[model samples]
Target chain A: MSESRNVSIRVPVLARVEGEGALDLVIEQGDIKELRLRIFEPPRFFEKFLEGRHYAEVPDFVARICGICPVAYQVTAAQALETLFEIDIGPWARAMRRVFYCGEWIQSHSLHIHLLAAPDFFGCGNAIELAQIAPEEVRRGLRLQALGNELMELFGARSVHPVGVRVGGFHAAPPPERIHAMREKLAAALPEAEALVRWTAGIALPPDAQEFVSVALRHPVDYAIEHGEIAASDGLLIEAAAYPEHFVEHHEPHSTALFSSYQGRPYLVGPLARLNLNRDRLPDDVQALLAETGFALPSGNVFQSMLARAVEILLALREALRLLADYHAPASPWVDATPRAGVAVGGTEAPRGLLWHRYEIDTDGLVRNARIVPPTAQNQARIEADLRLSLLNFGLDHADDALRLHCEKVIRNYDPCISCATHFLRLNVSR
Target chain B: MSANASVRPRVAVHKFSSCDGCQLAFLNLGEDLLTLASRVDLVHFAEAGPLDADAEVDVAFVEGSVSTPEDLERIQRIRARSRVLVAIGACAVSGGIQGLRNGADSASWVARIYDHPEAIASLEHSTPIATHVAVDFELWGCPVTGTQVLGVVNALLLGVSPRDNADKVCTECKRQGYPCVLVARGIPCMGPVTRAGCGALCPGLGRDCYGCFGPAESANTDALSAQFARLGLDTQAIARRFQSINSQAPMFRQAADKARAAGNE
Candidate 1:
């Protein structure tokens, strides 16, 4: 076959992207023409359901949006609602919440790196196959994931969509013994997390580079996870409250999910954006480890997104330990929450990237309007843009399987939570 | 269990209109996921691996609700391929939190929310798997826990009927030595009628149960509603309490309707 022969490749289903989505690609004369990363997960109508519901129900309501990162939903919702209430539960509550978020990062990142992304790296079909060759390493990764789940269960009664988080603070605070027990488990899991960073760093990453805006939360006191000012690599800084004013969610004819852009351009979020924006926030030892790994910083290669995730895992584990070190139960688990009519915004860095929530509340504490822009939807356009560049860079002359696998690799690098991403998709392609 | 020890029974996990939380219950198994994989021919599960939609399996774990034209057809195919079908969460057994739309004006809801309602194709109702196909077993939770998932998988491996606790949440609350938030703090709790799989999680944390696990077998929802009214909860407040998480379930749906009706009267 001629290298320049036109080819049409269709992946009926793309796995490990969180939910149901497809990829349709068409190439003419070895030059990529149309690539639609179609996300067809059924629209669950969450925003519509939120109308007329009490602000108190918002946390649990959003938590059901994505299973893997329910805390991201719960935390983001709580923060946004509390802003409307004008209530801050003090230092103890804030620290506990951060640790809780670290738990989410640890588990979510661990699942992606080991179960989803690792299989792709080793050319294995899935985690079951990956476990066969690297049993000990996979077991270690599982332990790290469990430790993260343990941290979540410690605060919330059970890990999956835990109901223990209320609007103001935790529904209940674990006693000193429970916290100490978790500390011991987390302490043991730290080395495994560091090993994961080194493991991911050692994997051979695809070579590609391109200029795109990188946006993430920037914190002066620490690595931004829960609260910070939103900053983009293009020198765009805005308060979390002003998120909607600066960014516009585009409704392209190609898809249903609202893909947001900054000033009419697709921007990047998640681990790469976070690390590039706040690599300095990492601990001195972690900084030294990054230097040892020989991965360059502020690079435009979207393939290096996994490396960004590895870096965050290390940061999450260290932060979890640091926050839990001097833990004391809050005098009260939650503070008084008296709802007043207000509109507010909350933004946090989920395992994948920036998760932003906006809400308008009525005088009765009922949610008048709610808008959730999860990380996956924000990266939809960026992923499509990368698809064309990635395929062209990899040389479309490669076999169909090779081209398809590389395309899947680039999407996996984003660690998309499709359940969270399924805001819209219909294909416009012929193969 | 089959006498042929060498033969691994085929198992598959399927999704419909869900948040992927229930299937996450299986992935959240951590190390146990690998163990479960060893014992079964893990054929299909999108969240955990590649999609093998046509693969025939001995058991199918169905999550989410039937809320689209595509979901209706897909559930039929999944049912045909499996010897035993189990509904894995409130979404699969009842219509999940999204099931809140079952009683409302779905068309107006879609139009008011979605920017391009024409682009979205969803069924008028989101109902449990049992409404479409026979469910051999049911495991109920807003998002079923890892332990409960493991328990069901083990039962399949051992050739025994899986243990599903059908008792009310109050039984577990009493066993856990947690004080009743309803009696002690005047909080509106659904523990009296909500199912028990969650270990009475909310009440233990000094919060009221919001009934994510759905109603228990022969649930005394009417009695609980009367108690809430006696405890000074207005009919509207009581209606919202029953009308959540598993709102589409018969017991809860009726309870919520009666509460609203009483308020109007």
Candidate 2:
């Protein structure tokens, strides 16, 4: 007969993580029993409400899904609509999209690194607490974050739900003077970003390398931030159009957000996955910085995601600098786009991972059906798996500490945005 | 208290019924965060860090709107815990995009969105935080700008009041020298009544203002509604303009109600 005991780990409030979520683990006689990452974030039925809205309103509407990465939603929605219409947004527009996305990367990655991930490395509850211990590091992280915000504000008009992003292109192209003013600050920020990358790389990652099906966009040239074909480390190459063919989302009873899988398997996305699959595609400067920091490709240690985020910051700084230096304002900010009645799919790399949006539009451009798969929803299963593995090795006597650390590690691995997860904690021990 | 002790104020970022975007703004601070952290202790931010729920705080940045019984209770608790509680974003200052259901039949909205409405529990109307608790200050936007967020933080830390100009978007549009879309192109623009902080974003984009920044102080919503009607906008269309992202905001709400009433007449 197996001895069984119920262990409930409640985190009154999960620290150093975005939004709220709680972990409930039931272990009986050391044999793994039940693990549930309960996501209690009230369901905001975006898909339901999307029906009957105009296609032109999608980018603006879906952008509200996540405040941190609204551009990802806006860009992906625009791309999908453009594809459906067979509209070509010229090179300048595409380049501008890339530039705009780089701003998102800088902003999102810096937020994840300094505020969300740093406290774990230093054993602090949050960044505010960490400030007392490491003020300079926090300051540097904020400055880098600020520069990213500045970039977004320059191009998008507002960082949160940017006004400039439209289906065809921006409402207005930034004037030369605004672009010029940002150049010097961006150039100055490059080294600070490089320093941050090194600092992140130096942190001691938790000892483990579980095999993960790393998924990200792979571009033939340049790092994939905005748009590209979906590629996995396990030799799966597919077009963005084929995403639905291979991947599936299941409605789990515990979460408002659906859990996703690839061919019945959990896959990893986000910075680490991108770094692993497209390391060579990175700009030479970023590649060299990674090499100098000894950041190996396909780093399976999820904790190193923070490091990967920092590296992306470096890449963003370099790219922003280059884009600014070679800046030529487009004559027209947008192309005329007329919506056609059809079903469309759009995929773009959100700050955390690949964000996909699909919409079915009527002849009048009214949305008939909408399906959005956020990065956090896709990452939920992998997080549970990691938590299971991490806990398998933990001693039961240290259950509380072990469970807490393991949960934090799992959360960190995916850089899970519980708020984005459709997304907190309390401890209950039953003997 | 020592001079330095008085100088370095404690800061707390709180969440209500929101997407956590406004609080994410703090994390989005990145490198500047280190400097800001040194200036103030971020005491209780559930999204950014783990802190005791009941911890006393100096300055609270509250995000989201009051949408449920829990939200009402939580906001009250937060108000009691903090010395100064500043509501951030549209959800806090005015009900956000989700507030569009206000003045409509809540039961119909619930039926339209949920497969099992009985499984869920929520208030009939989504309201701003100030409806439940006294808000010391408010920063408006769907998701507020990082600059405005930083401005408030810096001002609070320095013991000075944050400056939020209660002007309409028309001021910014005039300053930017953009041609009037309403007059030139016959678009139904809300620039005359919408708040200024978003820098006339929609107008800059060659679109009429959708009023994401909410209505300005003492906004002439009545005149704007009349102008929109004169521009060939039907009552339903005019109602929709006021019924968008900042639907529950007083100025916009009243205008939308009037438009709906006109439609019935």
TM-score of each: 0.96, 0.89
User: Taking the tens digit of each residue's C-alpha lDDT, what string does model 1 give over A1-431?
Assistant: 68678888898788876887888999887677789988777777787678788888888888888888999989999988888788987887889889899888888888888888888889898988899999988888888788888888888877778877888898888898998888888787777777877888898888898889999999987999998999999888889888877777755444546677888888889999888888888898999888899877887987788777878877888888898887888779889899999886899998889988888899988877777888988998899988888888888888889989999998998998888876422211135
Give residue A134's lDDT in candidate 1 (0 to 100).
Answer: 90
lDDT of 2 by residue, B1-265 (tens): 2235455777777775567777766666655555666677666677766476677788888888777666778888888988888889988888787776555566654444444456445677778888888888899887787688889888876779989978999999999998899889888888888888877878887788878888898888888889988998788778878877787887888898899899999
Candidate 2 - chain A - TM: 0.94
Candidate 2 CAPRI grade: acceptable
Task: Write candidate 1's Cα lDDT for B20-131 as tens digits.
Answer: 8888777777777887787787888877785787888889999889888888888999999999898999889998888887767878765654567787678888899999
Residue A118 in candidate 1, Cα distance off native in Å: 1.2
As a TM-score, model 2 comes out at 0.89
